[model samples]
Target: MTEALYLDNPYLELVEATVTAVGTDGGLYVDRSIFYPQGGGQPGDCGSIEWGTGLRTNIKNTVYSPDRSSIILIPRGDQDLPQLGQTIIQHIDWARRHALMRMHTAMHLLSVVLPYPVTGGQVGIEEGRLDFDLPEGETVERVSANDAINALIRADHAVTTEWISDDELVANPTLVKTMKVKPPTGAGRVRLVRIGADIDLQPCGGTHVKSTGEIGEVHIAKIENKGRINRRVRLRFGPSAESA
Candidate 1:
């Protein structure tokens, strides 16, 4: 099993790891990883791996093994695979990963501002979005929601995580906000992300900033109607063009 270093420290950008196995499709498996594999609406990480003899390989993406037991680092192309048991330094694209972290945390705040059941979502380096289940006759005012989100961002709520047993989560169903995506279970536990003291708490396995202040100036760029009751809110870094 690969030790997921990001779950403990999203700010970690580099670490020394040992190559344990090579996948059938040329993916490299490491004993431990700083890379965040693609899942839970967050994109996989991309970076480079440096080995002995000044050798390096560019990682295009990170993913999970078919059984979800191990993390796989996919090379950018047909790069040479590192030998098994080779010691290497894993380096994640810090700038890109940090941006995604900021956006991800901001999305959490967005859920608070809207306070609706989330139907879907996506986290990106420059922007992030959440689809809410808004009933007919209800609406989300862009200006108000935008101001509310920025207020929380300025308040600088501390972001933290904790583990709960699968049974505990099963009892407290209200802790879940997303109507479509459920937290992974069957491992006997689930990871919950909490913002501030009581601002928001939910099951999430994605990377996030340590504080909301890092999210900076974000605005609701657009709100689209996906269905009769689904409103997709798009969030972008910096102030909205109209406000700027």
Candidate 2:
């Protein structure tokens, strides 16, 4: 099984690993990895791998195996492939990944403040968005949402993660109440992210900031009606709503 280093430490940008297997589809499977594969509304990591001999390959994208036991790395352009059992160094594009972490954390805060069910969401380097199923005749208020979310950011609440068994989670329904999207349980165990003592609690697998203040200033830039019940709210980091 591949060790997911990102789960324990999201800030780990570089790591040494051994190439365990090479797929016929030109994907490389490593023994351990810090790369965040594409899933849970967050994009996959983009980075490169370097062999000890000075040979390197650019990792274009990462995808999880069907059983989640390993991650497949697709190379970008033609490059010398590392042999199985060979030692290699993996480096993640920290600037982009850091932005995604901030955006992902901001989205969680948005879910906590906004009183609506989330329909969809996506994290990005430039901005992030969440579509919500709002109540009837409810108007979109960017200023109010922005103010509430920023207030929580200023609170500097600590973020922490915990593990809960499937049986235990099922026994406590209230523990999963704040989750915008229900986590897939049956995987043996689930990770619960707690923002503070009682500020916000949800099941998440994506990378996030250590505290709310690290999210900086997030502004609700736009709100559009995608359907009768779907309202998409876009967010970005800035002071002016128009610029964000």
Candidate 3:
């Protein structure tokens, strides 16, 4: 299995890894990876991998191998592939990843501001959105929700992560926020992301900033009606759409 360095240190921009194998279509499998594979509502990381002989491949995306053991780096069609067993230096597009982290953290704050069951969500580099299973006839005030989200960001709440056993998570089902996506449990442990002392706590395996303040200014771009009881709230970075 590949060591997922991103989970432990989301701030890491570069890493050294060994090319363990080459997959079909020029995918490079690495023994250790800082690139986050697409999962948990967050997209895969894209960057570059430099190998021996000074050759480098522009990684288009990152993903898990079949059976989900090692990480495979998908290079752009025009990039050259490194030979297996070669040591490679991996670099993350830190600016892009940081934006994703900030946006992801903002989504958590969105969940807190809305305080409703999350039906679905997605984290993006510049924008994020969460679909809430809100009751019919209830309305989310756009301006107020935007202000609330900004308040949390200015508060600079610390974001931390911890692990709990599957049994513990089962005992405290409230820690989960998503209705359709169950936390991966076969490993006997699940990762939890907590903001502030009690701002929000939920099972998440995506990358995040160290503090809410790093997210800077954010606001609700729009609230769309997806269903009779579903509200899709889109969050965007920088000032609120009205204020911007």
Candidate 4:
């Protein structure tokens, strides 16, 4: 199994790892990685890998194995692939990852503050969005939602993660209450992200900021109604926004 370094410390942009295996298809697998694979509505990470020979190859994208057991690092262009068992160093594009981290955490806050089910979502370096399944007669006003989110951000609440066993999760159904998305179980343990004392709580594998204040001032740039229930809320960070 590949050790996902990002899970333990999202701020870690660089890490040393050994090439566990090299795929015949030209992909490379490392013993440990800081690269965030493309999944959970978040885009793949882009960076580079450096070998002992001082040769560095740019990573164009990252993906998970079919079984979600390992990560595949796709090189940007044709290059001499690193040999298996070779020591290599990995570096993540911190600017991009940091933005996504803040945007992702903001999304969780959005899920909690909005009185609707999330139909869909996406996280990007400059912007992020979440589509909510609204109830009839209820309209999601961008101004109101933006104001509420900023208010929470100003509160500077601490964000934390916890692990729960499968059986314990099954017994406490309320522990999984947030929206339609269920906490991942049968994986030995579940990771829960908690924001503040009673602000938001949900199962998430995505990286997030340590506090709500790190999200800065986010503005709801657009709100699109895709159907009777699905409404998309787009968020953007301004130039003066603080970094996480």
Per-residue accuracy of model 4 over 185-226 as CA lDDT, tens digit each: 667988878999888876777888999999988877778889
Q: At residue 36, what lDDT does model 1 achieve? A: 95
- TM for every model, in the order presented, reads 0.98, 0.93, 0.97, 0.91
Q: Superposing all C-alpha atoms, what RMSD in Å does each candidate have to the true structure?
A: 0.8, 2.0, 1.0, 3.1
Model 4, TM vs. native: 0.91
Those runs of model 2 whose alpha carbons end farther than 4 Å from true positions after fitting are 173-182, 242-244
Q: How far off is residue 117 in model 4, in Å?
A: 1.3
Q: After superposition, how far is residue 160 of candidate 1 from its true place, in Å?
A: 0.7
Which one wins by TM-score: 2 or 4?
Answer: 2
lDDT of each: 0.93, 0.86, 0.90, 0.82
lDDT of 1 by residue, 1-244 (tens): 8999999899888999998998788899989999999999999999999988888899999999888879999998767768899999999999999999999999999999999999999999998999999978899999988899999999999999999999999999999999988999988999999999999999999999999998899999999999999999999999987789
Tens-digit lDDT track of model 3 for 44-127 = 999998887888789989998877888899999977788889899999999999999999999999999999999988899888
- Clash pairs detected, candidate 3: none
Better of 1 and 2 by lDDT: 1
Clash count for each candidate, listed in order shown: 0, 0, 0, 0
Q: What ranges in model 1 sit over 4 Å off? A: none
Tens-digit lDDT track of model 2 for 1-244: 7888888799998999999998887789988989998988899999999996788899999889888889877888667788889899999999989999989998888988886777788899879998888888987777777899999999999988888888888887766543366777887888888898888877788899899999999898888999987889998887764545
